[model samples]
Target: MREIKVQLYRGEDDNYVELWKTVEKIEGKHRYYGRYTYGNEGTWYSVCDPLGYCELNAPMADDVMFICCDENGNEAIRYSNADGNKLPKFETVIKREWNKAKEKLQHNTEDLTKNFWAECWNGDTTMKINQWLLSYKDPDLYPEKANDYDENWTGCWAEKEIGYEPIPDTEFEYLGHKYQFTKVKHKHEYCGIEWYEFVCTDSPYVMRDTPWVNDRAWIQSYMYLGNWFDDKTYGTMYDQRSAREKVVAALIKKFPMKNKWDKLLYVKKKTGNEFYNCDCCYEKSYSDMADVLINRNYHRKDVDYLCKFINKETEGIVFASNRGNKYTIRQTYPDIYDYDNCLI
Candidate 1:
């Protein structure tokens, strides 16, 4: 069996530390495996065969210990301040940072929720004012009549004075386009009678006014006039404006333009991997799976879905696996069984 050993050495400048690895052969000769140079700036450059070299920035205490694993990735040894003193493990540093980030994210989410409701609904904000301006209730089709009416309620139940002239089976210019308005008869269940309503057949957009309550009501009225207004419907103005604001807020949260957590959250969501500290390994695994899917002629969307599924389903297994073990779909998922079978 192969054996590996790790050693820490002070750099030539004495300002940094070099972490070196050596693999022992059957003949007892040691070969260089990799090295990482850690400096005071909280960044390190890792150089290994095949994978080449890369820089990693991790927030770690200066006195933290570097835990070295065996060839099988078992914690076999640890290096502290060179005096055999107790120190925090490498994972401890990563876990602390992750926890801090999670707390910040939770606080930001709460703030965002509160701001959305306050600025969009409760306050006299632009969105709230716009909603108020757009709010409308359809003219009461059936007004209640009072037995004895006062001067204040004289016209409360009077028939509507304003009438809409029918411009039927003709084309009219609206928003720089000619649209045909057709006169259609609709039947109401309550009245058991038919009424004539005019509708624009080919228009730029659905008209919200006239015989319909809202855009949805106007669109559905073609099938049946009973759909002109639903009893459960919120006022058209409030519903439409509220819906727009909600969509805007959702989009902002999903893809934050300026926040630092935006990129982190996006990567986590896309890869479906929670171990952000292992992004390099996660990316390599994701690429390998993508290549396999591409070779099978799977669509891009399908490949993305399969990668997400594999990452999610194998998350626990990957976490429990040996640190150095390559977390591949074949090794983690049940469908692939083995490296030779690429069923997924």
Candidate 2:
């Protein structure tokens, strides 16, 4: 443990030292364990990092406590001039400053939560939340570091302060549909697994709204392979899946394998794999058996059902699984696109 010192100042009218911190260890970390600042005379000092969520001009106001260190950071006298200052107990001042910072952080979090819900719902989502913190004038919130704020910070704040990512109302034209996705900033978006809005190019205005879907196939077919919205902004990453793969996933999700023809069902009925062979294919588990069946062309009937769904919904979207469920997009690369084994 390195020797360090703490100081309390009025930090209101002027930067006058009010008290010296005689004790150490408030909550297990250094008193100034957040950020650093460069001084006018060339020096480095600690600043509360989370205090960035609070205003520096707060009444009674910001950082009355500061961390002071020397060039070699040698042990320093705890209370050099306490008798002259007639200061309160070291904990008293520390708690006072600490409590204020906590209350301010809580207040900011509540404020952020209120503002986000108000704009997200009410049918007027502009999806321009990157500038949500910019409306309030400075000296109130991060006035000193306002220029450094942007979508990156906004996203980070939402996760930390707001506790959820804001899902913007995004739309796109692909796979013969004009789709849109909207949600309360704190909710999760989808990929046939999460949640989103999907509609064809000619969808009626009345049919344009976020829907609660139970099946991945229904939503994944309409979502971006990754997504138009930056997942990083929400403290999340969008999945990378091919459109054809998504279609196949949907088909497989829709497939009925209750019959004996499916290897899983065959194993269930026989209840023994000692010397069993799914046409010279042997597996001890259902997952392994399924992969063997699909990759080895044991799913000929499955292809028919899958390709039918793609053709009817996407119109000429030839689904191919030659490359392990991920097929080529015919419109973009026809020469390499092959559906001969698709059986549809």
Candidate 3:
């Protein structure tokens, strides 16, 4: 989670200043709303729920609080404690803290973009990755633009395949500083690519600060395999089916295969130059090639990690072997290996 420090303009409520000035309180709603208002204004101030505007059944607004001020000392709003011990509102501390948050978010976004691009080429799109991207683009960075984007975005349009709403802004008290946080959400296009939106809030931060992203770990696990072992080219005009074939062909092309039988050896080959065969040869079943990938010590290390198709039907890993046949449960099961291991 990222953090940002804000100053309290005179006339801003003590509650508002206190709320927008902490580290912990700023991380929770980091990916949601950028707007934060106290419960003193009634539940009507809450964009947290879908109940519209109305007085909430919460407590008084004197617990912990803070005020927001522009660089010119224009007080925008006040944040206050509804039920917790009041926290202190420090101008310098808030500013310093928030600066760190912004840096982390920016770093995280850069890392996420690289991973996202790689996964797109692999025919897999994890929602967690998309959600992380939304957080990295935290709405606070582009409040006006994010709000405008949300106004037109239709989140979760196709079941859960689409995007989610902004995280919603919130405030909380910690170590005498009340922290304010904004949540962010995003929308996805028909191409399955995601774009961001914001839902500003006035709540406390919750998530802790951490390294933006683990680029080394990501590169070691994903980049290494894609670049070296899998023999899979990226950004090509192919979906899952076509992608599998291309990978298999890539494997064949690496060998000295000459005939159908030799190609079968290439298909079933585990490793070494012996596995190399002429490229002109073909195999009767694509499964023959899959068997090679499945058996190899190198590919096996992370093959299942890359192949997300494991299920009761296609068995083993979801990778497309040979020509894409031999889909069954038995072959791919956790504790079995043989021709009958797969159902198909």
How do all the candidates rank in terms of TM-score, highest first?
3, 2, 1
Give one digit per residue, the lDDT tens place, for model 2 in 1-344: 23445533212212321222323667775343221111211122333332333112211213233234322333322222211222333323333433433332211112344445745542111232322222221222344533442332333222311121222333332212343322212222211112122112112222222344332112222211111233223211111112224333554554434543432111122224634422121222233433322342212244345445643543322222223323323223334312232311
TM-score for each of the candidates? 0.15, 0.16, 0.21
In order, what is each prediction's RMSD in angstroms?
Answer: 33.3, 23.5, 20.0
Each model's total of backbone clashes: 0, 4, 81
lDDT against true structure, model 3: 0.32
lDDT of 1 by residue, 1-344 (tens): 22234433222223233344443343685333222333223232334441233222342343544455444444555544333433232323333333443332211112334435755653322322123222331123222422222111211121121223233334433212344433444433222232343333443324334344222233211211011222243332232334334333433443243542321111112254544423222222322322322343222343444444544533433321222333343344333222222122
What digit string (tens of lDDT, one per residue) describes model 3 on residues 72-154? Answer: 44454445444332322333334444454444342122244554664566432333333222322223443443433321222
Model 1 whole-model lDDT (C-alpha atoms): 0.32
TM-score of 2: 0.16
> What does the lDDT read for residue 122 in candidate 2?
28
- Looking at model 3, which ten-residue stretch has the lowest summed lDDT? 219-228
Alpha carbon lDDT of each predicted model: 0.32, 0.29, 0.32
Off by over 4 Å in 1: 1-180, 185-255, 259-344
Relative to the unseen true structure, what is the C-alpha lDDT of residue 226 in candidate 3, on a scale of 0 to 100?
Answer: 8
| Total clashes in model 1, counting residue pairs 3 or more apart in sequence or in different chains | 0
Between candidates 1 and 2, the TM-score winner:
2
